[model samples]
Target: MAHPISFLKGVCCGAGLMYFMDPERGRRRRSLLRDQCVHYCHKATRAAEVVRRDAQNRLQGTVAEFRHAFQHDEPADDVLTARVRAKIGRYVSHPSAIDVDASGGRITMFGSVLARELDGLLAAVRSVRGVGEVQSALRVHDDAGATPDLQGGVERRGERYDLMQEYWSPTSRSVLGAAGLGLMATCLGRRTPSSMLLGTLGLMLTSRAMTNLDTFKLLGLGGRRRGINVQTGLVINAPIEKVFELLSDPQNYSRLSDSIESVEDLGDGRYHKTVRLPGGAEAMLSERIVSVQPNELVRWRSEPDSFVPYAGAAWFNKLDDNRTEVQVCMSYNPPGGVFSHLAASAAHMNPKMLMDEVLMRTKQHLEGSQPSREEGGERTGAAASTGGHPAGSEPQGSPRVEGASSPAQAGEPVIHNL
Candidate 1:
């Protein structure tokens, strides 16, 4: 029952060290992380601006309402009539067909409205401020089939809520996320059964509000639609064939990535991996390579019952220079649902951070890693027989990947990142 919370914070400093202290690509990763932080800060600033504006407007509106409540003066006839029309517009199919006449403190409506909407329209018109009495001379219709006023008219949409909609605006999401966090913190601290239930509710609210994912995805219930996503691309200073060889073969992961303790190749493109968890613990995983193309692409998915189910793919494109661009995409089920996923992200144990480390190691291994044959003039007969070639030198007849037909571009969307 070791929870992700227990192992979370201890790994952040260590993860940062490995993430930024690597000999190769360390500077680049640090730069990218800094840019992300700056971008996020800008977004936060914009959101704060919007929130401030909204608060100011709400305050002004509240003040206006209070001031208007004290002094009662009937609006002009045209103004009151316009208000009545506005109030009842959404409840009926044809507001223009309704003629509103307002004089003194009384209002009258004369038009043909749908019979179903007549009651609502009268009610809405009656609710308008500065109106004393309503005089109805409206003709009602069951349908808009032959009525000239209701022809080709449709009812406007009524009041709808942001939370009730399929997609919420960014502002709504932020507000919900903030409220959910507060509720979770307040409820979970009581240490009671009821408090625990409330805390779980708060956690779901926070997760769904922030990620905008279905509950099923966050709970890791659906096939391939289970939550969490990691996607990024980088160019390594190695040829396409060399980079593909290192990435496509699972055996090299242990040496190339700090997160991997070992990868035991089971032949036939299957492997079992021992992964180092946050607090120095380990988790076992079994994955079978689902597809592969020689020096071009590699795709794999975790076997059922694996510690954390995941699927990933990597694409290789040979640049004009000797470098290769590697675009990787991965989705994985969180070990303990979305709560644990968020915890791991806070602890730098998320897939994005791990992939950054792994790709950095790959860059280091492929770039200038081979030993020189003329080091201190200590050359063996085997080195001479190999024509002074480096140990990691290219093999014969490796195709030069120079077109866009094989791999997607860096900015192109790969798999569904959600």
Candidate 2:
């Protein structure tokens, strides 16, 4: 089966090359190839520069470490402790909250502090003189309140999403995109079946990389989401009211995703939804509409009885009389820990993909187009509602209410499962 698929793909590529290299169109194709080559070359140069700089920094650090070890013995216990404390204090805004202790070249940090502050505190302590090992006994806290365990470390709500974005930022995309393009160009220039096969692989990679979609999880280049946040957006050629109406109905969900087996309305803006996962497994969720501003915004959160804790919001902006931009954002903590996150990320089954497909289907359905098989049929019930403006009116802006998650920005990468 795999061999046949590979053969067909090769044949398709050969045919595409013959067409693109036709006498009349060959010049244009050649020009495109040249442009792509130049673009990729520049990207390669930038990447090389980054690598060189990083290598130099690492080398310098190593040299400095060796020099220090040779020149000075470990400092006295009290002196080392003072130095470690000062180092930790410099990195944190609220040093008073942190209590640092040093004994036998080991340092222990005890305090109630924000999660983001932990990494720096540990690093700083390790860099101090006479510090052999660092132990973090600190209690971490976020806006949500106190947390006792600091083992996995607490991350800010969207830290994973932010990291993923930085990883696949425009610059990173360009570099990968150029590599893909270069491969295709090489195949075209070579004009051989073997080259075509390689080009096909390149094309696949390029398509995935250029779209800001993280499809190469097997290679570990895919985005990572943390602490339950997913944001995605799409533009629709319909008024805000019509789009909002379509999304508010729970029935439309099945049309967007086949995974959604059923949605049951539980009244008072609450719903019980059953979902079929990839392996015939099923999970149920209880959700309630927390906020609604007609045609402008809608938000929902998981009920206490839900398996996964989650919150989400959608925002509608009128781009024009015939076009509206819709944004959806979701944040959830998956049931299991790191292993579950790895599985979901590797499978590309994260919430960002879910919202992406949903928004795409919503666009298609509202525009009277048939939803793709990859996307499913519409399910029924209202998931959320906002009470601000009428359709097509200028939104006063999202409400100042507490607990409302922000809508996903277009092309923003979100962490999933983590």
Candidate 3:
């Protein structure tokens, strides 16, 4: 009687009974639950299968890596040198600075190598089979120390291809994703503490595996190197000057989208913005106006100390007299990680999607042919140009996203070229 969990269980049972016994929609709800269970069971069975039989492009490297176990014969000298060089480049930042040579199955590496990298390079070279001996004819420097050869070089173009390092390979994804799905399927709807904990962990792991992002990046804990970009644009039924003026100021953001609560101008080209987050929460960010070119473009970024960091830019293109293409590009470390994005996307809460929505509203507002924008241009068919939307009605036009890198330039780490 005194146990809180017991009380919670009783309450949950009562609620479930009430829910399933409802006269109106209980049957539908029960049927939906049954269908979901069957679906999840099938998924769990597949997850438990470990790896698929067919080789996949993403899994090619992992498959090849395992082949070394069966490889007993030594490769030719040139092939061995290529293998060592390929393997060693990923372990060091400056690979080109190091020279690789192999003769009679022996490797001789000679170049200006970093002192810290020497051990790793040597070990990696020794890992290759058919190597008789290794000779180091290299000048090792403790630090870059103005060393030309050891300075300003990165690992050869293989690290990005190798998902086994900092990134997850297809094999890792298959195993981990299956485990997560299987766990969640088993724990679904269980109210016990351990069950809930496991369910949460399963969800996190599944999201991580599905997104190929580490936990730090998912939580926005500063792993946002070369951030995700959303670039999309659409033509608005308004003059270039009118559209440009509206977007030139941050205050107009709220006018274009209902999701924006408010944007307060705080003088000196800065603003305080309040936006609705996923799940009906709100966040405030301090923003800096990086640059502005009238009737051309505007760029902005969140302050470093702000709780949420983001950068964006909008470009105005004149298309004849009464229409303009508004190209918007937003790049940011997605806050709350990949799962949050998946959820938000399901709910239509994606930021890029919002851009389209707001512009539609802005287009509607402009289509009304506000008196200010119509300086004696006389009567034109407003509804005809904008499609027939009743006056004061909401806009329903869809905005198109570029899906390419953003064009607006932002500060380091976040600013990627278009």
Candidate 4:
């Protein structure tokens, strides 16, 4: 999250670098400007202010002239760049990437920077007046040095999905409760005797547990949808390890996440992640690594009864040209019997949108990572290497993934028990 202001300041610094690096040009330019400033300064104590105002006023006209030249599509001047640079340099604290040349306006920046901040940059430039339109064919690089990580504030998108899910839980619970009451009444009406009632109660308990398990399975599936699950994906232009490094680091919560507070790796790829909710609520999720095949996939599951009933899994796949696709799936059973149902329902409604946020952020993180090709393309699973297969890899287990599937396919179907 590079601040537009900071970038503009950097642009000014870059100008200064160019100035000092070529002192002859700087000195010559300063000598000409110095004479004008001195003559104006002699008139009053506010001479510098007057001179600055005059320079700015003149620059405005020059900028307007450039705009006209562009509108008419006429040949522009090359000296305009130096002239405008010198003029604006005297008034503003720093110069932005809005440098001009005799031909047109030339801006030097990173592609990511342009992608992230071009709108703001353009807005600032437009305010300068005189500038008709920007003629930019600037080539931006993917520089590790220029990638600035902004502080993670509240994740409105994630929180919105979470809140919607939370609200849905109540509605779901009401439906289930009504369904349960109807079931119980029907059983009582049949009156198969006292023994039958006991059996019915036992069946209900088993059924409830199974239902909870079934919910978990849905959350663990890649891009799987349930009543309210929102699924989304993003592409990363870096290695999986690098993406994982940022995702695995709790400190990066401040850098990459909007609302995650902390994530403590609980050994064996299990983790305790605490995320902030909208309206100041906090959710503590206990997640276990249901499956982990480095550079390919990482899946986690957590039951509502254990530390946290909410479960989530992330999968990473490498694509061509150093790009990677990451997907996240999460499901949660709300807390408290009735409230839990509402929450669960809410989780179902927009699982795709929430998951989309995870993927997009992951993409941004990976694309912004240090550029260096890893030694290997993908990591082979230990289970596959050994005489073992993922939990659901066998035909007798869950269905096989079509092709180039990660080990996560095994953990998906089992997410929902009942």
Candidate 5:
């Protein structure tokens, strides 16, 4: 097979040589090919030059525009200060709380401001005409009694009043109870197995209505009354003290968790956190450190007026000289009642998965390794049943908590004591 194939290749090569080496036509054909190559090469070079020139022109235009927008000739200190103040007044809320000082075209802003508002305020002041530089000495809300107006106007107040009234009204509860009784009556008339089940459900609904509980809350089908719990644990190859230091600082949360966009220190153990939601939306939450037990435990609770009320605790247990086990527990009430509960369940937005991801990232960051997927099944099995076991005896598994983002493996830890 090899010999025949080689002979065929040699014959083909000879035939091509005979055709191309035709004395008169071969030379002209070769010359035409060379000329065409040279022509295309020159054309390509000219095209390249044109593209280069166009790119240079575009870069110059961009630089000029940037300079025109950002760079300005210095003006008198008083004039620059006035310009900056005007800018701030136009953009920032509670302008009266801010004090402006100017020296050699540099503007300094001092006062109490909301953490979310500070970045935009500073950027606006710096962009003002005639201002050379801007500095902020702004204290946050907790430091200076500058809490933002989370509640709005008279109409909003009225709506809140109405909602509270509805929640507490005996008449509303009576109506729900009547409907449940009617259903029970229908079930009694039918007297079948399905009818009996329906009657039982109706009786339960009636009991809930009598007790002033919502249907979803009574049935435990949604997180309307009770908050969802999530718990996760991980072992990090870092000292407990070092891990605690990083976890204690609110500012470090944004770096540790992908869901947290930013953490603003509001002073006095309080922080304002901006979190990114599943669908590119964002939410602002206020949290305060409620307890700190050095390298052992840190606990935080959401502010009273937050959109979603939540509490979280991180427990640090030293495993060895350079290894530590971190256990996190979070309980939260999803906003918007049953609808929000359904949404959260559908989106798989549970705290357990979020905490697991956070721990994984923290471990990678401390150990100087690239982040990888969460490994192993949750370790909550025997440890959760032990009822607050010693730190050293806590199992290295995740807890089987309600509202888990993912299905748990068999023997998953269940935490009813969070």
Candidate 6:
């Protein structure tokens, strides 16, 4: 059998040709209807794609905005909930309901929240890192106000919330997690049914117990003391020595990082540096050069405060040609260990995520031409100390290194074999 679409296209083309050849009004009229239908279908498909893309973009933005608004609160209840409700209300055919419970610290909504909209809501709810759960007791409704009666039903709906009750339900997460562990154990078949069941139950209990234990011990955890470490490569078109020279100069840091406000060389390879934060807060950080071996390696330790302790080090390995691999590693002990971990989870502060950013900027700095740099004029004190003794060579019992470098000194940038 012939393809129906192909046959229709052929018939339309033949009829068009016959009309043009004979100048018959009837033939032309038939051709025009077919052409119009095809054109309209194409336009409809394009329109649908545009609508889909726009919807996706809006959803992503909503999720991001909601997450930003609720990053810290548990069972978050704030303007974000209202904002989301408004956004969702726009799409639903029903008037939405939002209930904010300050006493219980929860936000609940109901009334015609669709399946697709659930993702945005869930994402917003989960963005609050410590949020225990997101209870989506939302339902979809099809009542759209006035019928544009083409094919689908028109209905309006909304959602309901219970602020007094917990927004997150741990029971559901536990069940799913336990099920996953049980399935894994069954596939392994390492033990008898009774033993397997007991083991799985024990695992689940242990997991929950550990989480509870952490919750109790949050304040004592060394979360604030520990920090993240990152390493990234920067390949300069110039010689490795040139790159090392530029890196060793404390004044160049501002060029490497837009965040650096100033660099005061103290002597040796150390400097007192100031950095501007996102909200215009200037942080005066005491950074000591822990190690410096010409262009081979340079490491530093930064303690923003007595509580925010972090150490970062990097080793420069020169690959053949102009490329260099800078290996960076950081160690941090967050304050209060696990207890204050939640407080430190915010971006621009987290050790792990911050390390990534540092690496990325480091790469950008070395790769790009020097931008603006603060004056690294004369030092009021002795030569700024190096970041610390060259990494592995730091005396076992020596104090942690922190310092900056002067702008005048140029050093070779080659990895020296131990």
Question: Per-model C-alpha lDDT, please?
Answer: 0.64, 0.60, 0.62, 0.42, 0.59, 0.45
Per residue, candidate 1 scores C-alpha lDDT tens digits across 76-95 of 99989887878877678788
Task: Show model 2 residue runs off by greater than 4 Å.
Answer: 1-226, 371-418
**Ten consecutive residues with minimal summed lDDT in candidate 6?**
409-418
Model with the higher lDDT, candidate 4 or 6: 6
On residues 1-418, what C-alpha lDDT tens digit does candidate 6 reach at each position? 5699999999999986786666557675576568768976996576456546655776798799787675655444555455555654434433333332322334455434444445655565544334444555565434333433212423423343321221212332334446656755664676777767767665544343223323222233443422322233434454567556655545544433334455665666555665444345554556667677897877776544423455666666778667766565555444453323334343223333333333344444555533343465432211111122112222333322222232211111111110
Candidates in descending lDDT order: 1, 3, 2, 5, 6, 4
Q: Clash number for every model?
A: 0, 22, 4, 33, 6, 63
Model 6: lDDT equals 0.45
Alpha-carbon deviation at 293 in model 6, angstroms: 1.3
- RMSD to truth, every model: 13.6, 12.9, 11.0, 30.1, 33.6, 29.9
Q: Write down the TM-score of every candidate.
A: 0.50, 0.41, 0.60, 0.31, 0.39, 0.33
Off by over 4 Å in 5: 1-226, 336-342, 371-418
> Residue 332 in model 6: shift from native, Å?
2.6
lDDT of 2 at 341: 43
**Error in Å for residue 108 of model 6:** 72
Worst lDDT 10-window in candidate 5? 381-390
Q: Residue-wise lDDT of candidate 4 within 1-418, one digit each (tens)?
A: 6599999999999987787557567776576558657854774345334446655776797798877666743224545444444443333222343345444444222222233334444444443323445544433323324433322222221113311342223223334445656666666667677646755664453334324333333233322222222234567787766765544333343233234455665566555655544345555655555666677765656633343344456667778657777776554433332233334334321223334333455554454532232454432211100001012112232212111111111111111211
* Best model per TM-score: 3
Q: Over 4 Å off in model 4, which ranges?
A: 1-228, 248-251, 303-307, 336-354, 368-418
Clashing residue pairs in candidate 1 are: none
* Highest lDDT against the true fold, candidate: 1
Candidate 2 lDDT (Cα, whole model)?
0.60
Q: Please give, for residues 109-210, the per-residue lDDT of candidate 3 as tens digits.
A: 888887777787787788777787899998989899888777677644333543344456555676777888987876886768898788888888777676
> lDDT by residue for model 5 over 63-166, one digit each (tens)?
98788776567778888777777776655566777899999878888877766667778778877777777888987663234255422212111113311532
